[model samples]
Target chain A: MDGEQQYIKNVDADAELVDRARAGDLAAFGELVRRYESRVYRTARHILGNDEDAEDVLQDAMLKAFQHLDSFQGQSKFYTWLVRIAVNESLMKLRKRKTSRTVSLDENIETDEEPIVREIAVWDDNPEQRYSQGEIREILDTAVASLKPIFRTVFILRDVEELSTEETAEALGLSVAAVKSRLLRARLQLREKLTRAFKRKGDQILGYV
Target chain B: MVTCKDFLRELGDYLDESVDPQVREELSKHINECPNCWVVLNTTQKTIQVYKGMDPEPLPEGVHDRLIGALEKKIKSQA
Candidate 1:
């Protein structure tokens, strides 16, 4: 039998943590929580734009996932399943605040002329290489936070969380076309914003931080 | 010659590699001669690369203790 895909499969492995977790193994479940908590927390924070709500959603999602372990049929990735729950929980929090960013399907928010989309300024230094890791994190977090929620959610799913475009579409209840359209706008807008922040010889970048 | 607008219109699909071969060919040609268009393609690809490389932030101080404590309570109640 061709068994090259396994680096030698064992009965006990990280990949089988979900199955182990399903069998009422508390340690297994705890490990799964540790593995995914940061991602779940970040997804919540990104959607809700705050720490307190993200922490609540994280707790709720882990508890809910633990309670309903039987429903996780092992078809999709466990993290993806967990993230779907987290995203929904985050959206519920947004709705309660009366400012749900995801209530609509159509994202025609901009007229496309006020900011020139085509004239992208190439960075003088490769900014990722130029900045410290902490600075880069702040820069990216700020830029993403500035995006319209409609686009930010799509970018978070497709780009940050590494979900497939179709998976992102399904998660958000958006069409694949809408996902692509929103992702395009998100990437373009972030590029423009980052360019302004990092363009050559510019003291202009310093003040935004 | 495909206008910069034409390239911008198909930007998403081009990046996704979902464009028709002929249109893809035209876009490739347009990007070769168009500095502004090239900048769009370059910087946008870089933006996604940078974000995707970011490590997820770890749970903040003491949050893990509270979460696990709550989970343990729920598990004990189930017993």
Candidate 2:
């Protein structure tokens, strides 16, 4: 099916599930949880930075979602609503611990008047070819972890969860301009991390040559 | 013509297809002729692509079962 058809199908399915769940069909609720648990878990994990805390947020968010199923008006997709809960729950945990790292979007990248050419290097090997899947994931996870929570949350929502700019902004309670700014910074930071990794790998290859 | 600075500033919007047609055309033109900006744009695009392709870490089976188990208990209590 085309994208629109698939979206409609998913909406239908979610509506059915939500209706069943609202009727106190625990199995139906479980099905909803099954569909979104991984995504919720990952978002929590990225936000909280640990599996134990993520697990706590996961259960708390899901339980809260279950308890408040009546509040879900179907105006938004169920998953989007659930993600907002998960993000809020994770942030709550961060607040409790007083460990939320906020990065300023106003921070400017140092740009030279003239474009610098020497810093750019043509990567010889595809990153996928240069690293194993596990290694790449580790590198990516570490890189994402390095981002400030604001940028990281934006990155995870927009890039990792594949939410749209509007959805991301709604989830984080930010303006579209703020989402775009943070997302650009997140992407640029991640690119710098990956580029450094690839440049190091390229240097190693040159040594062997 | 869009300068490298102008192109970099709009790079995200260009990739997102949110920029106006005229701005996109200018950015595209600049990237085509400027290798430095091109590499930056290319690598950044690749980075996003790779990140999007990376699999989300699956919820552990134990955690999954435990969550459902806990939720079931909560539902039972409410009932």
Restricted to chain B, the TM-score per model reads 0.79, 0.90
Q: Is the docking of candidate 2 incorrect, acceptable, medium or high quality?
A: medium
TM-score of each: 0.83, 0.88
Residue pairs clashing in model 2 are: none
Q: List model 2 lDDT by residue over B1-79, tens digit each.
A: 6887787678779879999998888888888988777777877888788889978777776999899888888877877
Off by over 4 Å in 2: A99-119, A200-209
**Given candidate 1, what's the lDDT at residue A173?**
79
Residue-by-residue lDDT tens digits, candidate 2, A33-112 = 98899999999999889999999999999999999999998988898899999998888787778745533333343333
Q: Which stretches of candidate 1 lie over 4 Å from their true place?
A: A1-15, A99-119, A128-132, A202-209
What does candidate 1's lDDT look like per residue over A71-114, in tens digits?
97666667777888888888778777866344443546663433
Global lDDT of each model? 0.80, 0.81
CA lDDT, candidate 1, residue A101: 44
